[model samples]
Target chain A: MSVDVLINEVGPRDGLQSQGKTLTVGQRAELIGALVDAGISAIEAGSFVSPKAVPQMAGTNELYALLPAAEHVAYSALVPNMRGYDLAVAAGARTVNVVLSATETMNQKNIRMSLEQTTSVCAEIMQRCRQDGINGQAYVAVAFSCPFEGETSQSVVRSLSDRMMEAGAGKVIIADTIGAANPRQVTGLMHDLVGSISAERLSCHFHDTRGMALANVLAALNEGVREFDSSIGGLGGCPFSPGASGNLATEDLALMLESMGMDIGFAAQRLVPVVRTAERLTGITLGGHSFRWLARQVESEEQGGGA
Target chain B: MSVDVLINEVGPRDGLQSQGKTLTVGQRAELIGALVDAGISAIEAGSFVSPKAVPQMAGTNELYALLPAAEHVAYSALVPNMRGYDLAVAAGARTVNVVLSATETMNQKNIRMSLEQTTSVCAEIMQRCRQDGINGQAYVAVAFSCPFEGETSQSVVRSLSDRMMEAGAGKVIIADTIGAANPRQVTGLMHDLVGSISAERLSCHFHDTRGMALANVLAALNEGVREFDSSIGGLGGCPFSPGASGNLATEDLALMLESMGMDIGFAAQRLVPVVRTAERLTGITLGGHSFRWLARQVESEEQGGGA
Candidate 1:
């Protein structure tokens, strides 16, 4: 891992897609604007999918047109299939991410396909990204544990990741779909992945379900993976996983990295206001586990008792 | 680190001592009994202090007598001075712990002693334990940060830990008195500590104030710490630190260690009800961040949905 790390904020996409209330395309742009102001360099802007399946992601093409500072920010979009990918590329999305579950049952439940079929579809999309010169990413969802299957096979994940890479995917993010990953599990799996794929092309997506997300992050960091996916104010959870909690909170991740003296570019203390803004936009009371302490720091600084 | 880790429950002492309400000796013993039934082996039963100073620890001597399974379970008490030490030994306490703050201002505010004076007193107590054939322990409180003093010196902590060991203390616990520790900080300090003093003779006490307690635990474990101090239901905080939250919750630590494939000597799922009993006893709502998921696991198991 380098001294500087990458923070990929996914609030506008992964976070909002699961919310009960759908945000207007305008309000979604406003949230992205606030994130850019908070110094988030990379973000998952929205998804290109059927509005009927995910109503919250309606009008993503319009939202992309209204995003702030297109020249400075690295904004990506999620695409479920070839049609979604075409729509995303047409909307001028330079980066696109795809999801492939490691287990057959999870693939059936999440996207209504078999594991093999999902892999084929994702592989085709990655090849298309290479042809189109788009920065392509793939998420190995439920990579650690499955609600339907107890423990996912590491060999299967490795093979799937290798196929994605061979198909021209730029990165593979190991996601804890049910947030059932432990540090030991992370260390064991990440050790294998980093050895096979090299660290620069790997990232991690964790949920705080069992409250081990940060610990798991440390484990992955120890294994040389740096880039991480998180949502502002810990905005979302898996719709299919019953006991799974929110995605690892952006402020918590930033605060931890800042505290460690690592460089993530943005000042974590400033993200407090962005969390409040996201809460207002979504009508969901949201805060990371460290929200209280982080707010107190911001308050103390406001009172001129600077840290 | 060993495959098996020791969970040192400090709820009855460090947890209760900071509470607003004081439980009767009988109530305290009942809480200890509940933890014992849940498979906790080592517990800080209470402190031998002036009742006027800390009313919650008023009947520690009486509580000691009512403890269950004296031979099977290991019970330790905190002693502030020679008088408290004499009382603890008189009450049949075989193990006693002493606290030494790592900062001067903390020592002044906590025990009305200078850091040098406090160290000397703790050294005397530890020496006394050696003469009396007792298992002696010392806590380097505020080893990470002091409330009045921002960041503590690592060299000072190392020196204090060394002195405690030299003074015949069986173990020295590195305490994050205000919960301002990060995993990187933990890794740096523990690397020094584990080198100076062997891992088997060291312990860690953390608070969840900034929500990185588990991450810090992982860092310490990486540096070979096998013993940790946590409280049931995250019962208490340092009465002196403004933003310091509760001690690391016993269930959270146990669950993380167990999930990491380590042997922590008990089923973490069994501690959910124990947290409930603690909340009822303390009249404060308490749960670790993972409490909801843990409770769900217990419920699933009760319904005979075997994992």
Candidate 2:
């Protein structure tokens, strides 16, 4: 197993943020701790945002305070603006992820800002991260294709990624916010991204809305992306984006990665119990077909070839 | 738009094969006709296998005979044996597909044969296909991972693919039979494939079980594979493979391809109606997330507001 890949778990932040029943600060911390125990190195802990805008991520600062401090285990907080960044830093988040869309339509819909304005704000946050000795990851949301906008151009996506890189971002996450991208688009954009930025400095975030997130990731991976963002048990969706399914499931992605002999330092089978817990807590279906099948498989295995 | 993509619609053969309700010969022809009307040039019409094993694909010769002999349509059948190939030839099949597993366990369970025996049979069939002026395509099942035996090696996958290419096969389809592959695996395999064979000769068949089918396709597309197998409304799963979901949806793949500005000659909006028809016919949910989302989007557009 090649220990070259970074599996950035996003279930705590992206997954829980979608559930209507928000986990308390302690629960969030526990979840993060569980992820750490499961051998995940990087984790998106929570987003520093207004409770009014995103109630689920309200107590992220408190949750971050409870987390065990470790050098190898990097906990990241999502921030949209300077205020969010300041809150993230105050909460002891050494890694901060700032997100903006590549298209104007998504920028307006997601954050109520223009692309230029979002880029400027992200740049400011990047500068802050650099000064504070924190790692900054810029999430290029809707980098593939936007729900509001029909298709995002490769040139626009590349420009946003380049700006984020220029702004001192440690890594740029090319996100398929709506899961509307095909392999060609993923490869094309990643090609443009790698041309300006190093492949090691790129990450991928994908939604399984149209069930192409992993495929998009593969396309990007072919272009040399090593880091990926995935939710545990597929417990995520954009609350703002009504029809989205979820982020690529962390366990499932890890399973695929490990099965391919890529060292992601995680076991998918070990995470099943956590998935069940999340499902019980949320009362929402996690992965539609795969999870149920996995449950039956384990049950059948335990039954020992029962009729 | 690059007009180079060849979408081999497997809805009739693969999609219906896994469904509960078996369409009659006429109904199957009508469905294939609808796909032809939608401008899909290549199609896997049916599989010539044992009636008991795959009742839905029974009497494939009858269905093949019933299909419209359009000049543009490249009607084909999945041949399991020399007898099946003879039946397909008698039915005027211009193209034939043969399946082989990269893993020994899968080949043993699926075809009850060793990998060597399966490869040898496929080779013989390919030779026969050449003599009969048929374009023979070999599908490397479990190319990424096997259900019974997990984590298929790249060497095993590549050797099988190489054998298929040497067997006078016109095209080779690398299938993630159990949907146990990630983007990294997909790209890594495609990288190997592209180096050894022409991209034009390679195709991909993916299942959406773990929701990486499209991502795998994207990676394959990045490596220059233009041909792909997709089921209409994402209908079809390997009955032998436990917990497997259907093939990558034709409409969804079309959507992503078109969104990327590559011309596969599929209209997602037009395909929605056919998908609905398929759901009605099969009494199985197909494209539940995407179809519902697309319908609402269209309805909202028609109403001049959010639906």
> lDDT: which candidate is best?
1
Tens digits of per-residue lDDT, candidate 2, B1-307, equal: 2366788889898889877788888888888888887777888999999999999998888887789778877887999999999988988888999999898888898779998899999989998888878899999889877878788899987888888888789988998887777666778898899899889889998887765566667767777889888888878874535334567788777777776778776566567777777777777767633555555566667799633
lDDT of 2 at A157: 79
lDDT measured at residue A117 in model 1 versus the true structure, 0 to 100: 99
- Please report how far candidate 1 places residue A65 from its true position, in Å: 1.1
Off by over 4 Å in 1: A1-3, A238-244, A305-307, B1-3, B238-245, B305-307
Candidate 2 TM-score, C-alpha based:
0.84
Judging by DockQ against the true structure, name the best candidate: 1
- Model 2 CA deviation exceeding 4 Å by range: A1-3, A68-71, A80-82, A101-120, A144-168, A238-244, A288-307, B1-3, B100-128, B140-169, B180-202, B238-244, B288-307
Instruction: Itemize residue pairs with steric clashes in candidate 2.
Output: A183-B218, A214-B215, A215-B214, A215-B215, A215-B216, A216-B215, A218-B183
Residue B170 shift from truth in candidate 1, angstroms: 0.3
| Error of model 1, residue A303, in angstroms | 2.0
Which DockQ value does candidate 1 get? 0.55
Q: Is the docking of candidate 1 incorrect, acceptable, medium or high quality?
A: medium
| Cα distance off (Å), candidate 1, residue B288 | 0.6
